[model samples]
Target: MRLLLFMLGRSIKPAVLITVFVSVVSCVMLTFCEKGGYVFDKEYDSVFTSLEADTAYDKVSEMADNTRAQNDDLAKRAGDYIAAHTKPGSTPPVLPDGLAGQAVRAAQKGGDSSSAGQSELYEFMGSSLKDGKESEQLIGDKLSGYKRNARRGVTDEYSLALSAVLTRDYEQVLDNQQLADKLYDTRAANTYLEYIENDMLFFVLIFLICFSSFSSERQSRRLSAFAITKAGAGRFIFCRIISAGLVCGVCAVIYCLLQFCVMCLSGGAGCLDMPLQYLKGYALSSYAMSFGGLCIAAVVLRVLLAEVLCAAMLLLSFLSKRNITAGLICLAPTAVMIGLSKSDNSTAQFVTCKFSFLFGGEGYVRVFSTPYPVVWLYVLICAFAAGALFITLIAQGQRREY
Candidate 1:
């Protein structure tokens, strides 16, 4: 226990420094970074606020109705103009003032001959007419879906308002049963999601702390004295692993808290009660957790994965003759996983990417005809891997020739 405490004390400084550095970088980037047309900006906040105040669903329903009506009216006008102007053997009428007329003129200018101009003009008219009709129909369908959900007591004005803005391009979510039951302005949730999506920083921190755990002692000749007896070597290995685990666990907790504080300061703390599924990219998740619960789960999972990484690094450090060799060996898999994170293959992503579980998705796996969350499956796998690494380290320690 004394040795474990001493080892932990030795790691405290680097662990604290890494945590502080990561916190500063995260804060600076999140605060100063331009969002570049991100949908959930101040405008979205204001719209959500207005919807919350209205509460009666009248404003949003009216907006949907108005948009549908305007699209239909414009489509009718464009169709009428196209019909009258395209009549055979008739003089071209003066173009009317408006977007439809401007579009016709633009199409006319693109053609090289009268027939070509007429053909281009007709094509533009037909496409515009089709687009307008399609848009109006889409709006109608969305509005009707909202009304149906409202009747089923599944959605409220807030859901309708959010659907109008965020789900405009996702026609399929119009009738999603998991649509948020109340107003949850996703600005806060989105901010939190962005923070947890990538864990490369944590990976690097784990590597720095554990890569020298055994190799440094070995280089200093202290490991030779410790490994002179099997019992002594086993005890020493156990202490080192425990100490590394404790340090990594502390670092994970500190980092999670710091980021959570940042999230709170950025106006997301109150949104922790929001449904997890309400967040972007999680619309299909059936987990019955609030955003806060999801954050807690992510923190726990990160700590577990960090411990697994610590064990692997410790094992490599034990085997390597030099600290630098262990560091390079530890980094190889980390780099591969980082590269694989950008891949489009879902299976590869689920296996190699931390974001696959950190940012929850449709993460269910069937076992014995029963469904279980994939995160738990990952936990089990990590447990087995850690055990195997520990066994390998102990066996190697027992056999090492001083």
Candidate 2:
């Protein structure tokens, strides 16, 4: 324990100033440099005052039902117009002026008449409701048809079972109860999501702290000397890895708290006690949590992933003879992942994207016949990978040679 404390002390010393500087800079940038200034103070205040006068849930439900009905009417009219005017394999005629015409024009831009028409219909629906008008009633009515379509034409047992599980999950989310009394403000959550999505500084700070975890000792020939000590190389390496992880964890906590403080100061924290589903982009989520709970979960998951990254960095530091080598080895794949995340490849995006798990309810994966939360799956995979990396570090450290 003393050795661990000593190692932690050393690891934290150089990181203190860097972490503080980075956290402050990040907060400043998030406040001022973001597209819309921080806290969205004006918008938040306006919405809060409006919500205070009206029952927010009732307003949302009424608007959603109204908009959904309008959307269906527009879609049916557009379909009928296209079918009446165009023959098979012929170009669709210019639609007449109306809401249906607008929908048809929007769909024509995408080339594929059939799929694009449905996409445009939803796009129109989304735009109509984009201004802080969302509710379970709206989501339920919209997704009801989607659920039916998802279950259609599944002949194989595996596909049939998977579809059933997914449809059931969607049904549960649409029917889940949410806090009706709380008022939600999207400003703070939007700021938080935007900040985290572009948070390269966090990873950079972790890399700086852990990139020299063991390589510096090796480079200075202190590693062999430490191997001869009573603690031995294995114990020494373990202490170093643990200390790096702990320091990284502290940094993660500091970062999250700084963000939360910013949100509070901006008046966005009022909605923290509201249901997570009430947040923008999360109306379809199945997670049973409040906005505050989601924030806490995001922080916890981020710290876990940070520790996993710390361990991997330590392994590189342990194996590499120089700190620069360790850094390059760590950075190469990170750069690739970032690039892939920006590409149009769906599979690559799914693997490299952090947003899906960070902000819950984007989608789910099936495990056998059961539907599993993407956040849970991501955490489990990271936990296993961290264990494997730590085990490899220990085994390698136990070798006789430095």
Among the numbered candidates, top TM-score falls to 2
Writing each residue's lDDT as its tens digit, candidate 2 over 2-33 gives: 99998787768678778888889888877764
Model 1 clashing residue pairs (backbone): none
lDDT of 1 by residue, 1-402 (tens): 777788778778787787778766765665443242132354334444665422323444454455445445656777778777786888766547885554454345333322333333333222312321233244456556756776787654545454443334334333332354455545555656655665456667677677888888887888878777554776777777787778878887887777777676767776687655556556444355667888888788778777777788888888888878888898975676567655667665565535435344445565654545577787788778877887788788767644
Report the error of model 2 at residue 144, Å.
4.4
User: What is the C-alpha local distance difference test score of each model?
Assistant: 0.62, 0.66
Which residue runs of candidate 2 sit more than 4 Å off their true CA positions?
33-48, 51-132, 142-178, 340-353, 357-362
Quote the positional error of residue 178 for candidate 1 in Å. 9.9
For residue 129, give model 2's deviation from the true position in Å. 7.1
Estimate TM-scores for all models.
Answer: 0.67, 0.72
Give model 2's TM-score versus the native structure: 0.72
lDDT value, residue 263 of candidate 1 = 72
